[model samples]
Target: MPSMKEELDQSTTPPLCKTGCGFYVNKETRGLCSSCYKADVLKKKASSEVPKILDVNNNVGNQEPVENHDQSNKVVKKKNRCHVCNKHVGVVPFSCRCGESFCRLHRMPEKHACKFDFKAAGRVVIEKQNLLCVADKLEFRFFKWWELPDMVFQSYHGWENWLDGLRLKKEVKDYLEAKIARRKIV
Candidate 1:
């Protein structure tokens, strides 16, 4: 059996309490300080005396769920809901083609043709805003390569070309044509 001092020292060492709280606590309460030990005992004692239940009739100040007055009058504008499921959600590294925000499920499929920019040619280009594509008479906006983070731009030649065109302030074709050709097996 170790001496009481040795036992206390072992428990109060720095390694044991590296999580902000120091290790040395009152010996009577293991690792807890005297105040903490007293507080815990008091809380337990108070909880033990609480009544199990009470009649609702005796409570007069309670209220039911109230509907918000402003909420009823307000019309929520759906801003860039996901194209796949149309759910308004926030996810990082999101892809936007022609102003539509596509969640991961609907964006970037394994299909090579789908990955290419079909609307890259006729799509609208907003000088500082976006790059839009229209396919089958449906409009889609893809993220302009320039708008991407700088670190992301350094990764791909296609993106670099696309960004160069955008930065030069002239409209150029989307560089995803190779993927389209590959998909057609041409």
Candidate 2:
């Protein structure tokens, strides 16, 4: 029902991206610009694709989305062999600290250039495995000679009456008598 001129005008200047990318939108893309459209396409392409990482600050000035690395080594290992490499495997396939399996040629960290800090991880393990032990000093109780006489009476229960009958030395008897008098006064 539209005229030729109307169709021409619509085709001449493609609509601005609905996402506000400032780029001309493609009708086939629904309303997004080429870059935004590509990103959306990639996001829905497969589950193995590395998810788009957003900046922490999320500056309003830059609206573009950050994508993953294109390099084979830098790209994430999605499947068994990896999405980029099509799961290519060598003779020996072993997992690394980077959370990906590598081949015989790239098994060593030096070969694949692992990002995990071996030294720091080792230090943490060592610290947990070997702990430092420190204990408090032991305490001892000392009793004076004057308190020893009282201790003897307490242990013997009723030795007060037999104290003089024991025929003890005069000095000992005098000491016991003095302690007994002190006890009666209290």
Q: Which candidate is the best by TM-score?
A: 2
Using Cα atoms with residue i matched to residue i, what is each candidate's TM-score against the true structure? 0.20, 0.30
RMSD of each: 23.7, 19.5
In candidate 1, how many Å is residue 51 off? 1.3
Identify the candidate with maximal lDDT.
Answer: 2
Whole-model lDDT values for every prediction:
0.54, 0.69
The segments of candidate 2 whose C-alpha lies over 4 angstroms from its true place after superposition are 1-77, 82-87, 90-92, 139-186
lDDT of 1 by residue, 1-186 (tens): 999999998876734322335554655675576666677789999999886565677654675644548666888655556656776657453455444556666655432124446455435444336745646421135544333565664555545464455553233343334433454321
lDDT of 2 by residue, 1-186 (tens): 999999998888867998887998877888898899989888787756656667788775777755656677686534456312345664545778778786656678887778899999999999999988867422222233334455565665656555655776787668666865776622
Q: What TM-score does prediction 2 earn?
A: 0.30
**In lDDT terms, how accurate is model 1?**
0.54
